[model samples]
Target chain A: MEKVVKILLADDDLEDRYIMQDAFSAINLAHVPFLVEDGEKVLEYLAQMHSDEGILPSLVVLDLNMPRLSGTQTLRELKNIEHYKDIPVIIFSSSLNVIEMHECRQLGALSYMVKPFTYEEYLLSAQHFYDFCLSKHSFPEFNSLINNFK
Target chain B: MQEITHISLDTDMDLVLVHKRTMKLGELAGLSLALQTTFATAVSEVARNVIEYGHDASLMLGIMADLKEPDKFLVATIKDHNNNLTDRINGGLVYARKLVDKFSMISTEAGVEIILHFKIPGSQKIISSRIEQWIISFNLEPPVSPYDEIKRKNKQLQELAEKLKESETQYKELTNSLPMIIFSMREDGELLYANSWLEEFTGETLLQLNVNKWANVMTPEDLAARWEQWYHHVAENKPLTQEIRLKNVLTNEYTWHQLSAFPLSDENGKTLYWTGFIVDIHARKVMEQTLKDNRELQEIKVQMEEKVRELKRSNLELEQFAYAASHDLQEPLRKIVFYSDYLYKNYSALIDERGQLYFNNMMGASQRMIQLIHDLLNFSRIYRDNLYLEKTDLNVIAAEAVNDLEIGINAKQAVIEIAHLPVMFIYPIQIRQLFQNLLSNAIKFSDEERIPHIKIYALNGGKEIQLIFEDNGVGFQEKHLDKMFSLFQRLHSREKYEGTGIGLAMCKKIADLHNGTITATSEPGTGARFIVTLPKEVVV
Candidate 1:
């Protein structure tokens, strides 16, 4: 049976979403990539999945800057929820300050990646995004990291 | 009398010669007429007396040459039938002597003989050729009874009084009726006369304004000055200009008045009076005082506003400083923490002990971050909290601080020398905390070669008590003295001098709350001396 790997992307840009969609199609991924426009939508998507399907996302991609709720806010809110709190939220942004990077980690974002200006960087990010979904998700180790943070 | 046609009498006559041409006594020729005029006026009084009492009296007349000088005299003879005529004739002779230069007379009860001489102004010879007779003498009756004497005295007195009244009326009209206070003061400040101006300004009548009564109306302040200025002005005969505050007689309200007076004097330049005119200026005086008070209040308000602006600017600077530290310095701290944790976690077996030590150093630097945050928070809290003041004894504070730090003091064998302290108004807990921090610094940063000898001495500087803390420690260079009181400002390595570098800075904040100053002095190897100057007169 084919693994229906679940993927989530929290970003506020329409053009970035369109470009990443094309890059993921090139990799021929079987899983569905869920794209939310803001941090609040990202939390809502995760909570809806826990309540309706009884399943958590394999991975989540977060953008640092958004209008009302940013990627850091999404990470903090997800860490507070009990059922979906252990899921890994990766940080992606156009401009990254080191303090913000550390702040994201402290707020429970698992990893960080710089979003480059060129289309080549977007394709590379898309390749890495497909690999992140395909790799078998580890629940025990990520759950323990969340436990240490608390 | 030869050919003398106006002859009326014979003087030393040879009566053997008579007038060849007789003339009436009332009609006479030129020179003779002139001579008769003189003769007539000369004896008119005698003639009136004679005609009224002893009528038809006569005198003998002649001319005689002086034997000694060039003057000549006319002689006249008068004889009257009255028995009292002889004495009267003698009186007439005295009258004739005054009229001419020389006179003589002899009289019997029947008639009198008088000699009157006429002399021209420059000629010595007598004018015997033109002699004439004009007057005669009579008896004078004695005065009447005592009642008649009184009546005559009364008539004279009435005439004298009429003259005095005329003069007084003229003076009164000349002095214009401005309800004058025409006063004459003696040189000794005695009021000689004061007029009705006092009665007009005050309700006092002229009779009530006697010297003693007017003196009673003077206010106590005026009496204290003794009217000395007015007295000197009048005494020296100078112009008087003075403003005096006096209470009105009827209203009892203080009225400021200005008196301008000129010295009145007689033609001989004597000081006769100080004639003054007064004008009320109470309203102007009040306005001037109000202007002065407003100016003082405005000055105080401007100073207060300036101090507030200064305080606002200082507060802005403190906020800016904290924000700048959080935003700019915080990024570097994140890099340190991130890299150190990365080196230890990802490459733990690959990195040797030296690299481990580097990571440890990075961690230590990151840990000083909390110190910076704490010091800034403490400074901000000082600005935010309400200051409570207390009467504090510095001696007790120092003793308690020494006892509390017995562990550190005994370990380093620290010798703490204290001095006499003053009782002053302060924040008691703040002062004790200040002592604890400073003593800890002295004990922590000690000399490697010797026991920490902390000498604390205080001296009263009249305005403030200056306390000096001297310690035999590994002192810093003088170049870093200014940075010693900055938050997290470290001059030495943590391996050498172990501290968060906030103790001295916190002590500085406490001193600032007391409106005091702290300064440090040190050499490379010699000990350090920290001087704290606190004002004794604290503003609570």
Candidate 2:
């Protein structure tokens, strides 16, 4: 029996979310993805999923910049909880600032990734994300994946 | 009651009795020792003259007591039987007149009588008639032996000599114990005295320190000016004070000393002697110099800080320019790219062939415009952010830049030879950008007939490291060399070369941030070489 992996995507831009969904569907990965507009909604969804009645996600992908609570703030808050500390979080931003990326990693993010400029580059990033989840590895193992791609 | 004693003036021995009786009367009247001797000498001269000239002569010593006033007097009377006095006796009368408080002679038919009176010095109060009566009775027995009188006068002389010696010792001790040098120079060009402190300071005795040549010890640089003022003040008879450097005999080093002097003059205002004190002032002079140096250094530091603040303000204005180009311009530009692409995709059938071609050109121009804005942002943001410095390997930075441009390198088929590079303290991202821009420029301007060849290497330049990038490409003319690294300066026409002309400018800006320089050299159709010199370490 094959287990269906649930993924959570939090972004502020509607067009960016649409493109990401199209990219995932184009790759033909067998997965369930939940979408949210901002980090506040992301926190709300996570809090509900912690109870017995809701479903918990296997991976959370967050945009670094948002309207209310930022992605780095949410990632730090998520890592503080005992139940969600082991769940992986990946930060995505338009900036290639190494200082911000280093801060994200220090705050217990699973990986830090840059946004693609073109649709073809976006497909490649999506394919890498799909392959990363299938491996079922921890945060340090995720760093190895980025180095191999590099 | 009054008592009187008489002594006959028959011989020299009688004259001696008259002198002794006179001194005893003065002592009983409480006169000073000097006044007592004056009274005795006057009585002896008058009595002797009377004996030599007059046939009968006698001396009477008595006390005159006042019943009402507290004052008492000692009186001497000499009488002779001969009436006429000789010229020799008149000479004695003139000498006796100046010594006594009162001198009178009464001429009678029988003889000449002389009387001398001297007021006694005592408490001005009447102690009743009984005290005056006792004084008269006491003088009546005062004609003692001549040997006893000679012994009493000799003892008084001995006491006076002892008092003069004691006063001289006290003056010497007072000057010796003073902390500073107290000196006096006499009018006849002689050094009179210097206290013991002067000997300790100069390590020379008073006789050895020749006062006439004292100016030789002063520093030559200050001597001429200070000596001129010294002589001017001395001639005017005014008090003088001066600070001068003097030579220390032990170390032979010049030390600052303060000398102050004033003239001692008589009632006629004649300059008698120069008296002064000398004090050590070297420590205070050194401290004053230290304070002046510290104030100068503090001023220089403040000026440098002001220059840094001015530089920061200009850099902030450049950042504002970058922000305007990014957001205010890119907002409209992004829409053009998005809509043009959309119109070409979904509405290509409805548009004419000429309109579709124009739309394609519009998209191309907007895309290039976006790249220009992005490069400008990167250039201006260098000073906008704080620089983080660490030990970085230049080889690693080069490898990363090569990896980033691997696809472009293969498409152009460029061959890059990298030599060993040294590690430096620098910001890693900016250094990588510098390498990437230089390498891509080499690939972009490749020669049509020949393959592209590039060499990247570093050489030590003592205090700096030189990173050289050489390329075998279509080189530029030597005349265009000065414009190579300027922003938006294009040497070639847009039809021949496709560029925004900001790559080399970005490389130059990055080098400048590290306190370094980038220079280019080229010849037509030969090659181009760029040399970037960077410091090994940066202080700030």
Candidate 3:
């Protein structure tokens, strides 16, 4: 019996979401990963925990900037909550500032990745993300950094 | 008593002495003297009151009995008069009230009746107030009557003194500062006093200006006659006006003096003094000549403008004529070149070597003449208009100019050094031409033994830009230094180096148009340096 590996992905644009979906199908991760339009819904699905019949995704991919709540804000808020605090949040943002990558990681982001400016680089970064989720690594084995609190 | 008295009435002459009973004699030996004065004063006032208010005045002289003792009698009675009396008879009544020990008054159809009793100690030297008031208030003392006229004269004399002091101070101030000679003389023409203005006008004081001593210094002419006429006026009390010719001791120039004199008199109607004033009218006469000079200067200014316009007009015509003449001349010179080449191609061996040499010389001279004409025209028209400025890189322009003449530069093996060329405000074409002409000349005139080396440097002087184009070439004699920028003034003959001799002249003109300066220094056979300084912002 093979266990179903669920993945949570958040982005703002519909066109990007569709293109990412097609890319996932091409990369053979379509069955394992699920998609949401923004970081807000990703947190909502995680909070339900059993709303989809007890399926808890092992991986969550986040975008840094979006309309309702920006990726940095969502990431900062999620790190504060205890139950969702350990969830792996990788910020895949459309900013190229090296300082921004350093800041996102400092804010307890599991990983910080810059969205590629060109089409070929975008496909390659997504493929690397697809391969990481399929490896089936245990979460507790990864590093945990506590974010700052005021 | 009913009036606010501005002038007292009763004391003006005398006071009333009224005795109603018989007199007490041997009152006191000294008391009668005092009482006598008192009684006289009172009686005089009573008489005066009688005259002023009643019709017929009378003196009242008697005695009065004391109220307690009939034997002790004092004098008391009204000075009687007969008429309808005025109410003003109270002047004497008031005198009697303050004087006697007991006094009373009653008015009747026979004037007013006043009664007074004078009582005092027998040893006393002072009389009672009744007697004292009667004597002094009525002016019975005779000496005080004479002082009235003296007081009036003293007041008049004081006012006259103050007025005379004020006028004297004003006269001193006016005379000392007046730009003339002022004097006062006796009516017979003897000088009395000279104002201190003589010190300023004649460089001599009043004492030095005595009439007898300085008569000749005052005027060379017959000024005695002038003084005679002036005296006639003072004697007749008429004004004197005249102009006398006087000589300046230093300049020896005779000057005309405007003289005016008038008579002054003492309190007596006799003429006592004559005052005169003299002013030099020479300077005022000289001012009239300056107006004529101003007119000539104005005429010269107009002529200068016309000359500048004529020069400008002729310059424009000359530039256009040069451009047109050169264009027409170049057409025929080109045809001559084409026909000579055509003849050489058609006839190969028809001419000797000498004929070929003659033809080459002809072509060479023709080409040289064309270049000379071109240069002559460029010099004539260099200052046609002001140089136009735009942002320019002199290095780039210099490089391009050097490249344009690079073939010649390489042919001469000349070493040119350029350093720190600025991005500046300049005319690209003109500057390029400037660099081309300068650089080419440096290469063309290289020393036969040494390689030609040229330096182009610029210095930034605030409000101006300066440049130096220096070269180690065959420089000429210093004797021709003054003519370096003159048109067609050349040191080297055409055989050695070909030039129209207008290059330096053109450089000078271009520099001037930009509100700049240019100069040259050279050593024979060594080199020449052309220094140019241009204002950073050309003055329009």
Candidate 4:
């Protein structure tokens, strides 16, 4: 049996959080997604997972614009932690700003994804993200799977 | 008139006696040495003619004053007793005609008479003789020795030398008194003469000055180029003019001077020497420099003004873009939210549960986008509109904002305490918007259990007015203070706080529009205090 993938999502918009959670459910992927509203809670959740017997997520999805600690700041903080460096992070934003996208990449984001306008585009990206995670864990040699999103 | 002197002309030796007597008359008449010789020569010629033609004759000499002249004339009359003396008088009158002012023959009934006139020197009129009758019978002295004639000639030459010396002294005084430095340089760059004026200017003697060593008194940087120009003019033997800086002996500092030179050429066009003068041009050069600097400053001022105009134009362009983004981009987003809501209500049963969820999410997103656009519109409108400022009561503006937020205030159970505010010059709409945004934020971010408490007050800060908004509610962390007023920056999740993240940004924009400043102080779980400072007089 394949191990269930645990994914952490940080987004300030409630609708966007619901959309991502729904995308995971509609795709029927074997994943447990934990959601947080902003970058500040994301840090709290990560620290709780370290202290408690909670399992760390295989991937982290971050929205660029949030209340307090932004996605770039969180990425910088996550990369600074030696143990969390290997966990690939994906940057998601509603804006099509290439400068922000490049800025996230420089901050060690594994992939940058723009929020889709339609339900169909959302479903396709969710399926792609799920398959990337499965390929990332099952075949460690295929870690370059993030390139498909690029 | 002088007494007449008579001399016999019978013997050839007697003509010399006539010459001596005529010369004596010249001396008594105060004639110059050259005129005295002329008078004596005329007398001898007349006496010789009388001797050659008549048997015996006598010469009478005297000085006679005329009516038209300041001085007298020397008159010599030869009386002849021989027959037809007028016809016998040959070239005597011709010789005397050239030497005397007048020569005439008077033939009387018994014999003939010849009268010759010589004008004394220093007479106002050169021809001082008119026809006059005279008769004299007097004895005159004989001629003096040759040594006496030579002595007179020597005295004349000595007097001429004195006159020449006086003229030379006057020329030297004229040249030395000039203000300019006049100098003469030989073809080989030798100083033949430098006037006293040059010596006074340089505070040095002309004999000690070196013509080729002018570079010693010139500025080092200008020496080589000016010397090359000087040498080129010399080689070409052409008249040249140049301006240079030379060290003033009096001031010991470099000063501007203009040198003008003319080459004195011989008949064959070979340059003999160069004569020139150096005139001070320091004052004129300074004025020229001042004009040049002022012109350059004017050019820079024009360039700076152009740059400022360009910056203003670019700012106006950016404001236009913001206005367009809010007004045009919001319409489509509103339609999207409306259509999504309509579809969800009318066709919910046909779509699956997951599809229904996605539709609701889309509608929520569109609604948020519309709110974002509305906030942006207000932010840009504050800058885009032409300001109409007037004295307005800020307390009344705050009350209106609170009245507009009554619904939200009641829902949050918030209490807003307002103090008396001052009347100041401000844009009414923008000031009202600022108050509304701050009031809405205070009511919206209250704690769940405790009722929100807010206070609005004003204080005079000397040159400026300070308006303070204090809220006892859930505040942001101190670390996020810098970004509190940035556009689309929020400290709480959208679910917890209903905002498009533009309230504080709008407030900041309103403050900046009035040429004021806005700052906030807050800590996590503590209350927030926002302070706005505005000048008493708005420049705009």
Candidate 5:
């Protein structure tokens, strides 16, 4: 029996979410990613899944800037919970700020990636997210991923 | 008794004359030299007592015969208006009584009288007429020896010395009572005398102060320089006037003092000594220092206000730039690019050739807008960003810039000649950006008739280094030099030259950030030389 790979993504922008979805589908990944609007919704979705005794998502992706709760605040809350602490999280942001990336890593993000602008770049980011979940490593290598963007 | 001579017993010099007249009487009375000395000594002692402790006193000398005996006597009588002779009779009077044959003192309501007699030989018959002759002979006698004149002068000198001593005591009291430090020093700067004020103020004696040349009472910080000036003044034999800080022993605090010294010279112009005074000027010095500090503070406050105004203006500009980039401009442009691409990809069958061409034009315009926004953001960030300086090789930065513009260089078939450049302390990223912009400009503005040629070299100008980028390209008129570095100031139209018009402005800003300058020399149709002068080492 093959286990299903489930992913959750949180973003405030509708267009960015749509593009992300389209990029995921274009890559022909086996599982559909669960999407939420902000960091608050991410916590709520996880709490509901825990209450219903449903399967938790395998990986979570977050946009750095959001309304109400930022990606850093959500990551801090998610890492504090016993059931969600083991789940891997990645931060995706439009800002190419090394300081923010380092801060996200310090806050227990498995990886940090820049938001892709083009369709081809989005496709590549989606593939990297899928591979990050499958590897199940504490820290993932991002050298090749960053080099491709350059 | 026959009175031979009489004299007023007034001053000490009168006592000397009394002794001389008594000796002459003894000689005239036929007394031996030994008896003459005894009788003179006895008479002079009584005279001295009258002068020292009596008022309205006189002395008379004569020859007398006692009624009870056949003996002649040389008698001297001393009288004073004071009747307190009993208390006035000191040891000299008792001694004088022993030297004479008879001595007696009587006190009356009118005055006091003292008489002395020395026995004379009867064989020396002196008649009344002979006594008159004796008196006349005494008056006719001159001073016998130089000893008399010398003795008189000595007495005068003693009186003068006494007067001088009294005046000196008065002056010393006056100096000691003064509030300031008064002192005298030797010509060689050794402390000679100081009044009570010196010890009262410094709590140090003249001996202790001279040990270190008053260093203990002075502030150590002001010592060396003050000493230098003092030595110079002494060497030049000039009056010294200086301000110094002196420490108070009780408070252990320093106060400013004005010290002045003048050399006391002799008639021959030889320095005798130096007279100096030290007066407190602490209050005046404090006020002057306070005024100076306040002036400096006022200047600093004005400078701070100017900086704040400049900061506010720049901050407002940054806010407007951010607002336009984030909301007014970039957001709509992003949507247009996104939607246009989506329509072109998903609905290509419904679009005619002209519609596709129009879509392409829209995409091109949006792309250029994105570049413009990005450049504007970079320009604003130059102010917002913290500068990080590192020692960087110019050759590496120039090579990287050439590599970054490789496609443009290939398209234009541009040739770049680079001379060896020095390593300098610089913001590496900004310098690389500057090199890239200049290289790209050289290639893009190449003349149609010639292949693009660029030469980059550095000239070391001691404190600064000038990096020159020479290009054989479509140059500009020299008159437009001021407008060239201004923001969005393009000399040519967009049809001929494709640009956001922020490249040279960004270059100028980068040069300013490094505390450097950027300028260019150009001819209208030939070539351009862009020069950037930068400090060899950046100060933090």
Candidate 6:
């Protein structure tokens, strides 16, 4: 059987969460992306998976503006964990600020994407995220793959 | 004895006249030139003695006949009433006695008298009648030779010389008493004379100053430049007036002084010497420098004020931009999210009836948002873009604006009356936008009861130009005039007049960019007039 590609997504806005779900569903991935309401829920889900000895998600998508443990803070805590350090993280934000994007990248985010205003653009961004999980390479090579999205 | 001529011994010139008379008498007597000189010399000595020691003195010269022998004597006798001559006559009498054939002196309580005799040679015989002729001839003598005239002139010149010396001493005293330094120098830069003031001020003697050429007393910083200027003036043979620093010996501090020198030239225009004076000018120079520095400081203060004003203006613009972004931009986004979520959750039910209305409302809000963003970008561009002013005709711009709004004008059947406008230096593109916005506003707000008549005209104020846009439109109340030009302030409801409400604000911004003002006056349901005043000449 093909290995299921598990993805975790975190966002604060309900509408943005719904749009991301639809975008992911349209791409026909091997498994559904696990959704969380905020950066704190992402951490709780990771802890539960670790305690239960479940498989770690291959990729984590985090929204920059979220309550309790923002995307950059979560990335820092995730990188500090020995087992979760290898999990690739991507930062999704509505702010088109290059400085915030650079800060997120410095905190171990593998890629940064501006949240698309339309469904079609979100669908395209979702395809790039799925491509990130499939392509196995060094962090630098993976970062360059989605660099044009910035 | 016979008297030929005599002069009173009152003055030294009288003594010279006495000598001349005696010489003439001796020449008339039959004495040789040697004898004449000898007898005149004896007579002058006794006469000088009588003049020195006597109150009234006179001399007599004549021939004396002796009955005992054939010898005839020429005699001279000096007499005075005052007998004070006895003590002073010894030396002059002894010398006279040796030069003459015979000499004698007698002093008495009444007066004193001196006598001298020279025997006339027998070959040059003299008679009583000849003595009368000799007296007449002596009276008629014009002058002995040029020597007499020269002797008289020499006496007058000596007296004049004495007067000149006295006046020169007075001049020296005057210069020494003056407060300033007065000096004279040779054309070659050697110091000739300096008044006592120079010595007192510098604590150096005139001799020392001459040797040093004022090098030690002058400030070193001013020395080289002063020398250069001095040489230039010397070369040009011109007067020099310059301010320089001089060290005061007592104070040991340098102070500003004005050194002025003029060349003392001869009739031939050759520079003989330079006479100069130095006066203190430190206080004046310091006051002038202070005034200049104060003026510069005032200029800097004005520039700083202008900078602060510009900063405040830009800060206000930034605040407005932030407000529009956070409020207007986010409003539509929130609505779109709300509507989309409702549709996604109730997709089957929303597709029946109310779903279309929700979609339409969402689309309208988004379109309005896009328009607001576009307008905000344009508004910000007015601040960001560099304004280029070019000389343009106002008539051409007005015509172009009308042409751009042709569709609107035809749809409303609006009539635009443009007066002949003057050419002006202005930002053509921005001014074009201003005209288009104003014309469009006038057309959009026209009264439906009346045909819209728009008049565009300009007036020439002396230092500024006034552009007027008058319209017969359904105008606003005067109370709302204050909010007319502010960003996003709508005077009418959105259903009545469709606008993002940035037109008048943009117009105000454009006016401010040109350093001009825009104001409007209106009465409810009547008409409106918008006036724009711009400087006749733009600075930048």
TM per candidate: 0.34, 0.51, 0.48, 0.39, 0.53, 0.38
Give the better candidate number (2 or 6) by TM-score: 2
Q: Where in model 1 is the C-alpha error above 4 Å?
A: A1-46, A53-150, B1-259, B262-294, B313-317, B320-324, B344-381, B385-436, B453-502, B511-540
Q: Which ten-residue region of model 5 chain A has the weakest summed lDDT?
A: A141-150
TM-score of 6: 0.38
Model 3 share of native interface contacts: 0.00
lDDT of 4 by residue, A1-150 (tens): 987678888998787777778767878853567889988898898889888967888889898878799999999999999868889898876643334665776777887765665566667777766677787423222233322111
Pick by lDDT: 1 or 5, better one: 5
TM-score of candidate 2 to 2 decimals: 0.51
Residue B382 CA displacement from its true place in model 3, Å:
3.6
Model 5 lDDT at residue B489:
94
Residue range A1-150, candidate 1, lDDT tens digits: 966677798778776676567657757753457788998898788778777875677788888878799888878888898876777778886543445666877887777775643445556677776566677332223334332220
Ranking by TM-score: 5, 2, 3, 4, 6, 1
Question: How do the residues B489-518 of candidate 3 rate in per-residue lDDT, one tens digit apiece?
Answer: 887889988888877777676776666888
Docking quality of model 6: it rates as incorrect
Off by over 4 Å in 2: A1-5, A18-31, A118-150, B1-304, B313-350, B380-396, B407-415, B477-482
Q: Write the per-residue lDDT of candidate 5 for residues A1-150, one digit (tens) a residue.
A: 756777899999898888888888998973567889999999999999999999899899998889899999999999999999999888887644444665776788877775654567777777877766677434444443332221
> All models, DockQ values?
0.01, 0.07, 0.00, 0.02, 0.22, 0.02
Interface RMSD of 6: 7.1
List where candidate 5 sits over 4 angstroms from the true fold. Answer: A1-3, A26-31, A47-55, A79-88, A105-114, A118-124, A131-150, B1-313, B316-324, B327-332
How are the candidates ranked when ordered by DockQ, highest leading? 5, 2, 6, 4, 1, 3
Kindly list the per-residue Cα lDDT of model 4 for residues B127-244, writing each as its tens digit.
2232122222222222265643543456458778988899989878878787778888876566888778766666666655574466557777797787688788999888889998
Model 4 residue B19 lDDT score? 71
Query: What are the TM values for chain B, all candidates?
Result: 0.39, 0.45, 0.58, 0.46, 0.45, 0.41
Proportion of true inter-chain contacts also present in candidate 5: 0.00
lDDT of 2 by residue, A1-102 (tens): 766577888998787788788778878863556789888898788888887567688788999878888998888888898888888888987644445666
How far is B115's C-alpha from truth in model 6 (Å)? 27
Q: Poorest 10 consecutive residues of model 1 chain B by lDDT?
A: B134-143
Clashing pairs in 6: none
lDDT of 5 by residue, B1-540 (tens): 888877777788787788889888888888889999999999998888888888889988888854556788998999999887668566658889899999988889988888887899656666678888998886566655565555546756988999999999999999988778898988556889999888888889988988887788887768888888878898899999999888888888988999999999999999899999999899999999999999999999999999999997988687567744543465456666666777777887898999889888887888888778767866665642545798899999999899989999999899999999999999887898899999899998899889989999999999999999999998999999989999899999999999989899989988988989999999966989999999987664
